[model samples]
Target: METAMSDIKIIMKETYSKLVTFKRKENRESFNKELLKVLPQIYRYVSKRLNSAVANGKLNKGMFNPSDFTDQLFIEVYDNIDDIKSENELHVFLFKKVDELLEDSLVEEEFDHVFFDNIDTYSKPEWDAMEENYTQDGDGDFLLLEELDDSSLDKTNYTLNHVFITDEEKKLADKLDASLDKERIYNHIQLVLDKMNLPMRTVFELFTNEGLTTEEIADIRKTTLDQVEELLASARLLLKNSFEKRFLIDSN
Candidate 1:
């Protein structure tokens, strides 16, 4: 794992170095060629953001394409790449631009609404009973169906694996592993994440799905490191508690 990560870092450094050279030479073709390498990451983020917006009724599915955002992101990167001083800054700058674009395009709303008062206060039976009532809307089903149609199946990996799990929570994770396959696990995780406040959900997704460090997330969100840490910690606890309530605890 360490070697793979080291290799990726090396590759990213090389890519950034080339980008800098292309920038200096005013070579748009080479710059765009290098930029296309990061398009998968940008596309993944855009797709997730758009899907979430559609699921929440904040945006119409027909109104935008994920590629549209990626194309715009590429333009933004092409225009602003010179502002980035280092490889580290390049990655953060890309995501920061995406967030800015999303903020401008999506309807502005307060994402701080508290969804759960105290998750720990709920009993297992209460959770099980509540689960029986849970249902996905047609838009959500359509979005998920579209996700499933993608050959890559990358969405299946977007679960609670990246969060810090306690020993007890590890047991819940194991239980989930034993009881459900990857797709089901991803579904359960998505449902739980969708219920969370937007800040928590966005921070968690950026950390887990995007594989960003807390410092990177802090930079992208334009928040303090402490605030990012708090949001992540809260997100982790909520995910763990959610899995325990919905999966581990038996009504029987």
Candidate 2:
């Protein structure tokens, strides 16, 4: 019987300790002090309520675990302890729990607000210097930071500060620069002019006073209509030959 009583005492102490420790990771010294104050209050409240059960041998220490105590507390004061059939009883019940939460002596110090303030306040000059160092690139222009011009859809309207050579133009230019012969180049230019078929413009440039037509050329050359047609055909062929010699004969 003595052994049973001792075991019951141990169970009460262990269960109460577990409730105070459960899910609490704050200051150990403060928590233990607060818990010490809470345990006696809980013991008194439970003991008074279960006096009949204890006498009847129904209320055992092993059955009253930390979870069981928490459950009982929840049921007791859940919808206002005043509704628990007695005013003085509910007052004493809640007063002890509230006292445990608000015990000023148990808390040795307030939260470190100065440490938080120091973290919030930073040196602006130091930040500015660091930003300058971070952004420093020895290059003349920061291409990445260039703003896109949204004003025009025409690609030619945009000017590249650096010489821009397209892949196709670059390749063709490179090949021509390496291999093109002088005669071939000259012929190609003449061929292009011939293809333009602007005899009136040429006549205006060469002899400002004299006006000439295709018929006049035929008469001067002493050719029939059919012969004139053949001569024009031959002229076209000669122009094509000249163009091929000048331009089509590609120089490296």
Candidate 3:
């Protein structure tokens, strides 16, 4: 995640260029090479999500093996990767597909493997909720909220400084020590973000999570820097206020 946005962009551009420059066989080979290079990062990212999902009770442990399932996903992603325009796009698409597929596969595979053992005790509502969570036509209720484009900007688009992540925010994030509950804070923050409209949420993810610069976010979302700044500022304001309220100012 610490990889700079410019470096990511350069890698994307170079890989795309390589794919288009070669003959049929060479291009396929080149694409495979690029995919191989990124596989470690992808696996680590996917493993983290799978672990989180299992922790959240969204996935059963004995249902489907994650490594094998990830291999299957990599194959599917490889087949579909040609349509992706950039590395970021590929990453976003991969995770979106993973989120959707993980639920279905876990449910269906568990049904297959545990048909006799848990046939009478199957929890349908949990499966239903998990399926509904990723539906494209549903209310945009993303559990991970990684892939999406945002065009809306707040009405009051203030032109703040290009630099974001103020010292206060950094200090708060870093102050996750023995006293504070870091997990609960982030989980609440994500809950708040999930309810937000697309533009602000998307900007927040790119700016804060992906370490993208304001200019990079603006260009990717095809908006002006001021608009991105406003969206990001709005997200920060909401988060900052929410955290302060939750943590309670300890004036000793």
TM-score for each predicted model, relative to the true structure: 0.80, 0.18, 0.45
lDDT of each: 0.68, 0.32, 0.48
- lDDT of model 2, residue 17: 48
150-181 in candidate 1: lDDT tens per residue? 43226565654654367756666776788778
Considering summed lDDT, which 10 consecutive residues are worst modelled in model 3?
151-160
Off by over 4 Å in 1: 1-11, 108-153
Per-residue alpha-carbon lDDT of candidate 2 for residues 10-30, written as tens digits (9 for 90 to 100) = 544554444334324434444
Where does candidate 2 clash, by residue pair?
177-252, 178-252, 179-251, 179-252, 180-251, 180-252, 184-246, 187-246, 188-246, 188-247
Shift in Å, residue 115, candidate 2:
98
The candidate with the higher lDDT, 1 or 2, is 1
Top TM-score prediction, candidate number: 1
Question: Candidate 3: misplaced stretches above 4 Å?
Answer: 1-26, 29-164, 168-178, 249-252
Q: Give the winner by lDDT: 2 or 3.
A: 3
RMSD of 2: 46.6
